[model samples]
Target: MLRTLSIRDVVLIDRLDLTFGIGLGVFTGETGAGKSILLDSLGLALGARAEARLVRGGAAQAVVSAEFDLPQEHSVLDMLAEHGIAVGRDEPLVLRRVLAGDGRSRGYINDQAVSVSLLRRIGDELVEIHGQFDNQRLLNTSVHRVLLDAYGGHGDLLAAVGAAHRDWRAAVDARKRAVDALEEARRDEEFLRHALGELDDIAPEPGEESELSRQRQGMMNGEKLLEAMNQAAKDLGQGRGVERMLRDAVRALEPMVEKTEGALKAVLEPLELAQENISEALLQLERASQRVDLDPNHLEQLEERLFALRALARKHNVTVDDLAVLRETIAARLAEVDDGDAGVRKLTHAQAAARKAYEDAAAALSAARVAAADTLSHAVMAELAPLRLGAARFSVIVAGGGDADAWGEGGWDRIAFEVATNPGAPPGPLGKIASGGELSRFMLALKVVLSKADPVPTLIFDEVDSGIGGAAAAAVGQRLARMADEVQVLVVTHSPQVAARGENHWRVSKSAAPEGVRTRVEELSRADRQEEIARMLAGERVTDEARAAADSLLQGTES
Candidate 1:
């Protein structure tokens, strides 16, 4: 609900502050008494396009501010949260806009500066301003489906449909990916087969390559190594070698021991130890020579296997040890190719299941909407005739079947509001067939029917009672009052009946200032309200008859 509106230097509404309440608040004045300045200033504050001409002549800028009392769960708070704007529930939301004299505009939400577009989006959630040719979301045919769904309490069903649609799309995407992979594998089938065949023929083992390399290095120089070992063994042996010479020395030392005491004995012992060490060295050389196999055929076989492993490694761009692992990977991919059709079939089944889920949810929502259309149409029609549109017929048209391609989160429904303003005229779209006054009244009726479902906290009608009077004006006033019971309502009206319906009444009047003309609005007391309504009825004069009529209208509002 709008708490207050402050206007400064906006056309003739300089320094005007107005407070609004829960019920109907009306602003009434004569034909050129600056009645529209109220709405224009409010519009500027609500993120409407700025006009430089709105600035007062001597002022550099114009400012309009509106304060609204928002509930904790209001969607406006959610929208602000999305934009990272924090608000305390105890504080009212304030929207302020400034129109500079040079035509640049600035916007603020609770003193936090925001872009014009963002301000407009937030404003859209806070208030809805309806004029005769209003192109607001309510009148747009595209949003009618949402309005109908909200009114019918189909939120859960709509959510289900949206989730199911996402699942279906995901299933389809998964199937497409599987099919593409299978096709790619088939294209490379021959190459994989040949590579696997080559690996199988050679039968490469994990550590076999390193072992072969070692064997090859040994065999390549086996003959020369064995010859050197044989010579060493012969020289170290006992008979005609170093061991025999040590033995002869030991015998000579033993004879000397008899003559020269301990010195000769020590020399003989060292010579004996030398002979034993030489024999052990000869034994080791013999064992090594026995282990060397100097066959040419063996050498050739080792070289051949080593070269094959190296070649395969080069071809696959891998080390020799990695070839075995690569072979396993290729084999797995070949097996997958063999199973491709089955995988595709599985995914196709999943896709079908998901589509069924979506269809079920969408069908339920569609049926509910079909029922809601009739009910909503009737409710709106009940309001039309009283607002001077008795000849107008309202309808809710739901179009679309369960076509997969045209599916949306709102289900497969295209809803539109159509009307016929003349008795026998064919009904067309609400915006197309209705004249300015007819459209406004139609919107008013629709609003009255959908007020509970609408999230907008404030509804402003800019002379919606444009071309109608008498009972029609009173009916418009009555509906506005009814709507205000659910939400705040502000109307700029000229009709005395509408003026009398205001829970809070304010009068707009213009006077010549020293510099120029200025507009002012005053909250009317009971006596002042009577005189104003009398002026509305009697033109330039308020006679006893006009006063009596105004009193009657005010008394009717009380009853």
Candidate 2:
């Protein structure tokens, strides 16, 4: 519900503040007294188009602010959440707009800057303004289906349709992904097979490269060892053998030892020790030469295997350690290619099943909507006669049988509320068929029928009682009062009967200010309300009979 509206420098409303309440509230004044100015200000705050002329002459800017109290489950809260705006549980939704004299404008929600389009979107969900010239909310074809569903109480069916649509879309996506994968794999099938064959032939094992290298080094060292042993043997065998030379020296030393006593004996002992050590060294060298491996063929085989592994690793752009894992990966790709057809077939079947489910759900919803549309059309017709539109015909058209492209979560029916003002005329869109006054009444009739189902918290009807009087005016007032029981209602009315029906009343009057003409609104007291209604009934002059009639109307409403 709207809590308050504040206007500054907007048209004739130089400065004004109004507080609104529950049930029906009426604004009554003579023509050109600025009742429209109040609505214009409200519209600006509700994100209506901004124009330079709307700003008061000589004013730098025009400002309008509207504050509303919403229920916890209001859809506006969800929209705000989606936009990353946080609102406290009890925080009121405040919308404000500023129009500069140059035609530039800015919009704000809860004091945070926002785009005008976004503000308008949020406004559409909160308040709906219905006037002869305004084609909003109910007149919009896009909301017709939603309104119908709400009226029909089709929450469960709508949920089913939504779920089925999501499932079908998911299945479709899964099938497309599988098909894409299969195509890509087919393009690379030849390369994958060839690489797998090479990997199988070579059969490179983890750590095999290091093992081969170790073995190759050992073989090369053995060859060098054999060469060194042969060189040592040649040196020893040159001239006399080392053992024979040592024996001759020792014999010669033994004879001299007898003559030279102990000194000669020391020399002979050392020569004897050297002769024995030389004989042992020759024997050990021969044994070591036999132990050394001189197989050049084995070394070459190790080099070839190691080099093959290294070259293959380079070709695949992987380290030698990863060659075994690469082989497994390639083999997996080949397996997928072989099984691709089966995968695609399975997904295609799933998609078909999902599509069937969605179609069934949508068909059921369409059936429900068709039945509800007939019932609703009759109900609206029942209301038309009371509002002086007896010859006019109203209808709820639920067009179905559209193609898949026309299907949506809301089901596959196109809903529209159409009307024909004359008996022989063909029915057309609500906005195009009805005149300004007739359109307002048509909307009122629709609102009365769908009052409980309408989600907007506030409804404003501008001159809804236009072109009617007596019983018809009374009927319009009673319906507005009835609708107000379900939602807040404000009416700009010239009918005394409608004004008398208001639980709250305000009188708008234009006055000559120092700067020029200015409009002001005054909330009426019980006595003041009767006087205002009398003024409405008497026009420029109030009469004793008009006051008496006004008092009786108030008493009738109270009763």
Candidate 3:
């Protein structure tokens, strides 16, 4: 509900602040008294388009702010939370907009800067303005189904239908994927078999490629390595080699040690150690030469195996290390191809089951909608006679035949509200058949009937009561008063009968000031309200008769 609206430098509204409460509020004034200006200012605060022309003539900019008391579980608070804006239930949600004369504008929600689009989206949930020219959401055919379901209390059934639709779509997708896979497998059957055979023939093993390459390299350099090993062994083991000389020196030192005793004993020990190291070196060289592979045939064989492994890897478009894994995957796919028909059959059965579920849910939803249409049509018709639409008949049309192409989550039915203004006339769309005044009354009837289901916190009616008076006007006022019990109601009206029903009243008027023109609104006291209603009834001159009539209307409203 709108708690307050503040405006600054917006056209003739130099500065204005008005507080509202939880009931029907009416704003009334003479023609050209700036009632429209008041609504326009409220619109600006509700994220309507801002224009440089809206700024006061000499002012540089204009600003408008609207404060709303958001309930704890209201959708507006959910939207705010989604945007990371924390709005406590105890705090009023303030939306502020600034329009500069240079055609620039900025929007703020709870003091956090936001895009105008976001502000507009949030505003849509906070308030709704219904007038002849403004957008009338009730006229939209798309909302007709939602309104019907809401009235019918079919939320659970609708959810079930939606869930079933999703399940059906998922089943269809799974079947399609299975069919595509089968087709692809059939197309590549020969290639897959041939690749599998090739991999099986080669019988590649993990780590085999690196081991073969290393052995092949060793064999390729075998001759040079063998020659160097032989040379080393021959040099170390020959008769004139260091080992023979060391043994001869050891024998001579043994004789000298016998003559010199202890001094020659240390020299003989060093000679004996050198001879032992030479003998061990010869043994090592002999073992090393035995291990070398010098045969050219062995090298050729290793090269052939290594090259075959590499060529097979290239043919399959995989590295040698991946060849084994690819073989397993190919085998698995072939098995799937053999089982393809069974898989397809399973998926087909699942899809059919899903379709059946959806049809059952949709049929239930359609039946509920049909039942709701009858109840809603009767309710709306009941309101028409009181609003001076006695001859008119309201109808809720259900276009449901379960055609596949027209199926939707809401149901197979396309619901719309239609009207026939006279007897035996074929009912048509509400927008096409009814004049502006009639449409307003029709919408009013629907609103009064659906007040308990409406989620919007505030509703503004702009001159919707334009062409009715006396009992009809009073009926409209009475309906508006009843709607106020569920949601905030604001009406811009000229009828004294309607104005007299206001729980709170404000009179808008314009006057010439020294600077320029200015529009102002004053909340009326009980006596002032009586005079205002009298002025509305008597026009420029309020006679005693008009005052008495206003008094009677007020009494009727109070009672």
Q: Who wins the lDDT comparison?
A: 2
lDDT against the true structure, per candidate, is 0.88, 0.91, 0.89
> Per-residue lDDT of 275-374 in model 2, one digit per residue for the tens?
8888888899999999776688878888998898999999999999899999999888788789989999999999999999999999999999999999
Give candidate 1 misplaced runs (Cα > 4 Å). Answer: 198-328
Segments in model 3 whose C-alpha atoms lie over 4 Å from true places:
81-84, 235-288, 401-406
**What is the lDDT, from 0 to 100, of the residue 491 in candidate 2?**
96
What is residue 502's positional error in candidate 1, in angstroms?
A: 1.2
The TM-score-based order of candidates, best leading, equals: 3, 2, 1
Candidate 1: lDDT of 436?
Answer: 85
lDDT of 3: 0.89
Could you arrange the candidates by lDDT from highest to lowest? 2, 3, 1
**Residue 182 in candidate 1 has what lDDT?**
85
Model 2: CA > 4 A from native: 206-323
Candidate with better lDDT, 1 vs 3: 3
**What lDDT score is found at residue 539 in candidate 1?**
93
TM-score of 1: 0.82
What is the Å distance of residue 318 in model 2 from its true position? 4.8
